[model samples]
Target: MSAAAGAEAWGLAGLASNDPGDIHFDIVLRGYDREQVDERLRFLGDELATAEQALAAARERTAGLEEELASARGELERRVPDPDVGFGNRVEKILRLAEEEAAEIRQRAGTRPRRSSSRPGPRPSSSTPCAMMSSSGCVAPRTCSTSTSTRPGSPTDSRGGSPERRVAWSPRTGED
Candidate 1:
C-alpha cells in the first residue's frame, strides 16, 4: 500500500500534536512518507513566522540607536571650540599683558637723580647735566640737605639743622 493509504487507514491519531516527534509515518514498499514530511513542514512554517517577526523588531531597534548616536556626535562637534581661533585669542591676550608689564618695569628702572646714601661728599652741582654712570646715579645740590642725617660728614635733615652749611662739589669734574 502507499504511504498516504497507511496514514488514512491509521487515521493519524497524532495529527493535532504540536511536535512532529509526537507522530509516526508508516513506510510502505520503498515509498516516501508523505505524512511525516507534511507534519515537519507545518512545524517549520509556524517557527519561521515567529523568527521573522523577532528579526524585524531587532533591525528596527538598531536603526533607532544609530540615529541617536549620530545626533549625539553632532552635538559634541558643536560644543568643541576651534583650535586655531580659540588658542590664538588666548595667546594674543597673554602677549598684550606681558607687554604692559614690561613697559611698567622699564619706567621704574633708570638713572634718574635721587638723594645720596653715603656722606655728603663731592657730587655734581645742580647746574651740571646728569649722566649715566652705573645702574644708579645722582646730581647733587650745593646745599647740605637730606631727609634724615646723623653723621657729621653726611647732610642733615630739618631736625634743628642749619641750612647755611654748604657742600663744595665740582660740576665739571663729573664725579660723585
Candidate 2:
C-alpha cells in the first residue's frame, strides 16, 4: 500500500504491534546504511506516537467540554421555568436543535478517517562545514570536522574523528 494509505490505516495499536525485525531491505555489499536508516525510522515512529497522543487528548478534552455544556444547559433549563410559551418555546427549540447538531458533529468526528501530517526528515547540523560553507566556494566533505566554538583552532565535535582542535586552514595556501 502507498505510504499515505498505510499511515491512515496505522494507529497507535498498529504501530505498537509493528516489529522492526520484519522489515527487509535490498542487500548489496552492506545493504542500506543500517544505523542511519534505523535512527530515522525510530525518529519517525516517535513523532507519530506523539501526534497520536495529542489527537487523543484533544478528542477527550472536546468530549468533556461538550458534556459540560450540555449539563450547564440542562441546569439552566431546570432552574428557570418557562412561563411564556412564545420566547421560552423558541429558546427550547433552538437548544434542542443545537444539541442534535452537536451529536451529529461528534458522530462524524468519531467515524471520519484520521490523517496525521507527515514530518520532514532530520536536518543536517548547521555546525558542519558542508552546511555552513558558501556554495560559491569549496564543497567540503559532509564528514568534515564540526565545532561550536566561534574562534579559530577550536576543538571539533567527537564525530570529526580528531581529538585535537580544528584549525582554520586555507586549502590553497595550506596555512592555518
Candidate 3:
C-alpha cells in the first residue's frame, strides 16, 4: 500500500479501539510524516552548529583586535615624549615673562605717559602680546599666558594638567 493509505489504515485501526472523532483521526493522519520530520530536525541542528562556529570565530577576531589595539597604545606611550619636560618648560617661561611685564605695568601705571584718546572713558587697548621661543631659535607667532598669579602646582600639572603627558619632541609627519 501507498504511504498515505498505510497511515489512513493505521489511523482507522486506532480509532476503532478508542472511538475517537473522525475529524481528529483525519487531522492526525494529514500532514504527518515521521521520516521527513526527522530529516528537517537534523538539518536545523546542522545549521545551529554552523552558526555557533561562526559566532566563536567572530569572538576570536574581536579579541585579537583588542589585543592589537592595546599593543599599539603601549608602543605609542613609549615613543611619545613627556610634555612636562618639553612643552611645559616653554609655557612656564612665557608665563613668568607675562607676570613680570604685568608687574612693571602696574608699577608704572602712576608715572608713565598714557596715550590720549578722543573716546570718552578709559578706552583700554585690550591686546596683550607674549612671545614664545623654541630651543632651535624658532619664535612662535602667538604666546601662552595665564591670568592667575599662582605658579603651576606640579611639573606634570604645568603641561595642561593632563595625567597622560604625551608630547612630541619634534613635529610629527602631518603636524605643522
Candidate 4:
C-alpha cells in the first residue's frame, strides 16, 4: 500500500476493536444493560474505522462517475448543433419551403380545367337489367336476360339506346 494508506490503517488498528456487534444484552423487566451500553458506546470503536474506509472508497467511485459524466457531456456537445447559429431557424425555413411547395401544387391542381367524364358511370341497380350481361355481349336492356337475347343474327344491339347501354358491336360471324 502507499505510505499514507499504511499510516492510516496502522492508526485504526491501534484503537479498540470492540463494537456493538460483539456486545450483548438481556431483555429485562426494566431496560437494557447499563454496563454493555457503557462498554460498546453505541458502535464507536471498529465502526469508526469501517466507516472511514467505506467513505474513502465511495469518494473514489464518485470521482470516476463524475469524470464519465463530464466525458458524456463533451460527446453530446460534439454531436449537437449549437443553438446560437440558426439551428432552429434552419428547421423552420425548411418546413416553410415544403409548405409553399404544397400550396403551389394545390393551386395548380385547382386551376386546371377538368375534362368531362367519358367513362361509364355505375350500372343501374340490380332491379334494372344491365345490357352487358346478355349472351350476345350486351343485348338491349329490353332483352337483358342471356336466354332472351339468343336471337342469332345481328352483331349490334339494333334496339340501341345509350351506346354504353347497348349490346357490344362485334363483326358478325358467318355461323351467327
Q: Model 3 over residues 1-176: C-alpha lDDT tens digits?
A: 43334434545333222232431322236675554444434444665777899999999999999999999999999999898888888788878766775687568666876443332322322324443434555354433221212124422344332222111222223232
lDDT of 3 at 52: 100
Best lDDT among the predictions, by candidate number: 1
Task: Please tell me which predicted candidate would have the highest TM-score against the true structure.
Answer: 1
For model 2, which pairs clash? none
C-alpha RMSD of candidate 4: 18.8
In order, what lDDT does every prediction score? Answer: 0.54, 0.50, 0.49, 0.48
Q: Estimate candidate 3's alpha-carbon lDDT, on a 0 to 1 scale.
A: 0.49
Q: Which ten residues in a row have the lowest lDDT in candidate 3?
A: 162-171
Model 2 collision count: 0
Q: What's the residue-level lDDT of 172 in candidate 3?
A: 22
Worst 10 residues of 2 by lDDT: 116-125
lDDT of 2: 0.50
C-alpha RMSD for every candidate: 17.7, 45.3, 19.6, 18.8
Root-mean-square deviation of candidate 1:
17.7
Candidate 2 TM-score, C-alpha based: 0.31
**TM-score (all chains, Cα) for each model:** 0.41, 0.31, 0.36, 0.28
Per residue, candidate 4 scores C-alpha lDDT tens digits across 87-145 of 78867766665576558756965998733223334233222233322233432233221
Q: What tens-digit string does per-residue lDDT give for candidate 2 at 144-174? A: 3322232232233223322222333223323
